[model samples]
Target: MSKVGAADPAAVLKSFSSHLIAQLESRPVKDDAERAAAIAVAKARTESTVGVLLSAAEVKALVAASTAIGVTVRQDFGTRVTDADFAACTALLESRALDATLALANTKAGLSALRGVVAKQGAVKAKLDELTAVPVDDALRARLWRVLEAEPFDARATVAFVMHELGGADVMREWMGTKESTSLGTHTEQVIERYAKERAFHDVKAPPGVRLEPMLRWMLTLHDIGKPAAVEHGDRNMQHAFTTPVLVELSKKLGFSEREIGLMRAVVDNDAIGETLHWNVNRDLDDAAKELRALAKEVGMAPGEFFELQSLFFVSDAASYRFLLERIFTTDERGALTLKNEKFEQLRARVAGE
Candidate 1:
């Protein structure tokens, strides 16, 4: 085959990415017509089927290039698709395509390119964790994502907040063995459940009497902190494993307590459980239960305690469950996402409101 197609996807991507970014930088699209013509010419120069698999750093570099031209990739980068071949990345042509990708949202191959617009790192002007939510859900979705995109939180404070609230003495005592957990703890492909029996959970609430909003907020911000390292390892999915040690060292340097440190380790270690299930969409009840139980054992928790604490990571780990209905395969396999547990539904709805 050609040198660019299969032989060197990264090189091919770099060449095309430079061209795309350069077009906007040079002439600059001052209106819709120019925007359409520029990207279309760029798209036509390469075969529609011609695309590249990117290393995490490469993808980030592409994103940076895209951003320099004022392309709003925050929505694209902020969102994760289970199986996104990154079809959207291949072409940055239309306006609506920039809106939330359709059936793509439901598929494992789902990854997004851009959304409405970009604003530096984005602003959390309102308490978007609550979805500020006066507008329709789609509008709210974009707005809330901007909330997650804000990357200016105090690294130490965020770590400390997480350790102080979720990582406790009890959690510490429970943090024995502590085997490393994979991003999608169960490594098959897809979380095989037609309908999730576990009432779509979202751990968005602050604890009983404490001001734990920051912890919850950080859950949104910090879950994927190790992505840069994960990408360096050439697998974006491995961020969870990398995040554990990365944060542990950061916490230690920040002077957190050992109790907090140990529990912090546990919390970050298993943060990928939700997304693992999200990206992979198998519905074998027996298989899922087995995976869940196995994960608990790996982390030295009785299955009960594991389930209880998983909520902490579900929010931090990934928002896959919160937005489950948007997934194409999820709806296809399960008809519609469901849960017998009213409590879980209530919790998820309060935060997600989707």
Candidate 2:
């Protein structure tokens, strides 16, 4: 039964929610090709749901597979354009050059080149197919590449498009793989470890479980998928921190559960460790407020901030972050890590403590 007496009329009506729903509905639903890509990811990730929250590698593989299959399909069904056709077309344009016009020849050449490129199995072939997938004429498609090649845009559409083909989550992960450690990763891991410590400190004897590790790991990996578009392709270092529209779309598309997405966004929104803790305390006014406040002070923040920070700390996976850190940074004699050495010690201590 619906709560009749005191429900907010706005909650019931949800004008903004309805509008968002409608906007989402208006978009083209993922076709079989996209769905198959998504399903392939789901299978690889062992996710129960049927969707496209694949890693960048998985998306790349899927795109390659799909493009290869698409090429075969087109080859089987469509007439193969020959070099003779292109020559004849070009000849039409030149009154005496070849008896074919350049325009017609260019068209024939473009079509044939497209087929050839699509049929070939390689990086360039995949990129060309992706580029051609856009709804535009052959001339404009060719022009797009020329413009991109001549002067790369600050936000290189080719990179973005290729990355998009790779899929958002997968691309972001790949981007992260290339960078040394992301500051966001540092801040996130620190926050989680701190929270884990605090939680242990409060309980004093409890083990670290109850859905924290997987949750946090997922959060750190996913918090920045939308950053690229948000920062408009700024330095690779800074993109992870920006809150782009792509993040939201990715959150919706990826197989992450709703709670996971919420928690992931919570970390992204409160990305800064200090700010996150401050928010935590402010949000809660319970008996542990004193403890949280004290903890916040230790971390160099107010009590309120400490509580808010706790939620963020445990919001994602400390263990996974630690693993990545360990994997990325080999330990030395003192068990001290090499790269991001200072940050590593901080995290090491936090993990060691609990």
Candidate 3:
């Protein structure tokens, strides 16, 4: 006669962890011990099998749970299956089999399914814990990622804001600083180069006696400076781009010249026009190229001479401004040609005539 024992923690943990624990408990096992082994071997031919060695405590709980639900236990070590193998087989016995004896025979196959569930439970729990430890919901994390990719906020401010709000500042910092940083946070030199290229091309022709290069650089830089500040706001107000005037005020306090302040102000107030203009027009330039040419004509300056003026405005706008820059300057068709001097001249003459 089999003796009854107290429940084992490990055994209960495993059994309770099953997705079908409630159902498993209600079913009863049919065959006795010796007959169950013969059936397990018969069914093992078609099933992918595994062996398990249960602790003595676990064995007792298994017996008790199984017996409470009328599960049959077969103790047959004589067959090719080892004690470990037979223990695994015993786990497979189904209590609700239509043919009670057949359930004992298919025990090995049943064990194979149970093992799969157990392994899956172990792995899934580990993964879930890893995600939870980050202290933010996955959906919220994904939203933060979208904001990062948008680069809609100031770099430093955005980083600080995200860290304060979300709890994984170090990882985010590493990601932002890495070579894999998004376009806005990517290499600063490349940004300068691209800004230079676009600024050199705004409008049909460089205005007579106007310096284009320096002015354009300054404008682009200033345009994006407020992204970090705006990110901190983290609201639908979309006030980052609107705060250019404030930066102008700050620059004046910092001793920037009146003329330099105007350039910064222009960048800050770029959106104030009655209507948003096309990217390449003389009046509503989207990026540095048009702005440089416009400023040069307005001030009767040249590209190189205006470098300091441009750099002042450029650096102040910060890295977050890339969002508007990309949208305004991007061509609808990939690889479209940007305006050159000749093209600029033709367009200018036509506009002048009109």
TM-score, per-candidate, Cα-based: 0.30, 0.26, 0.27
Give candidate 1's error at residue 190 in angstroms.
24
lDDT of 1 at 277: 42
Tens-digit lDDT track for model 1 on 1-354?
122222332333335532222233433434665445445544554433313334454556654555443342211231233233245453432233543354445433432333322331132222121211222334533433343234443333333333343332122122112132323212101121211222234223322342233323433334444444455556656555555544455444433445444544555554333433444542343444455566555545555555545554442223243344343222224343333323443333322223
Residues 1-354, candidate 2, lDDT per residue (tens digit)? Answer: 111111332222221111111111112333656435433432343312111123334334433443332211000101224564444334435644544454666777899889965553253333324322334345644543443344222223333332453333234433343334544334334434443333423222111231334444434444555443333344544443344233443434433355445444544544333222233432222323333444444334333333333433433333235554454444456543334324323332332332
lDDT of 2: 0.36
Determine the backbone clash count of candidate 2: 26
Q: Which residue segments of model 3 deviate by more than 4 Å?
A: 1-190, 199-216, 240-242, 272-353
Clashes of each: 19, 26, 32
* Models, CA RMSD each: 20.5, 25.2, 27.0
Largest lDDT belongs to which candidate? 3
Off by over 4 Å in 1: 1-221, 271-302, 315-317, 320-325, 328-354
Candidate 1 backbone clash number: 19
Top-down TM-score ranking: 1, 3, 2
lDDT by residue for model 3 over 42-127, one digit each (tens)? 23422223332344554566556555435423222324435645544445443223453566657768988888767644433442
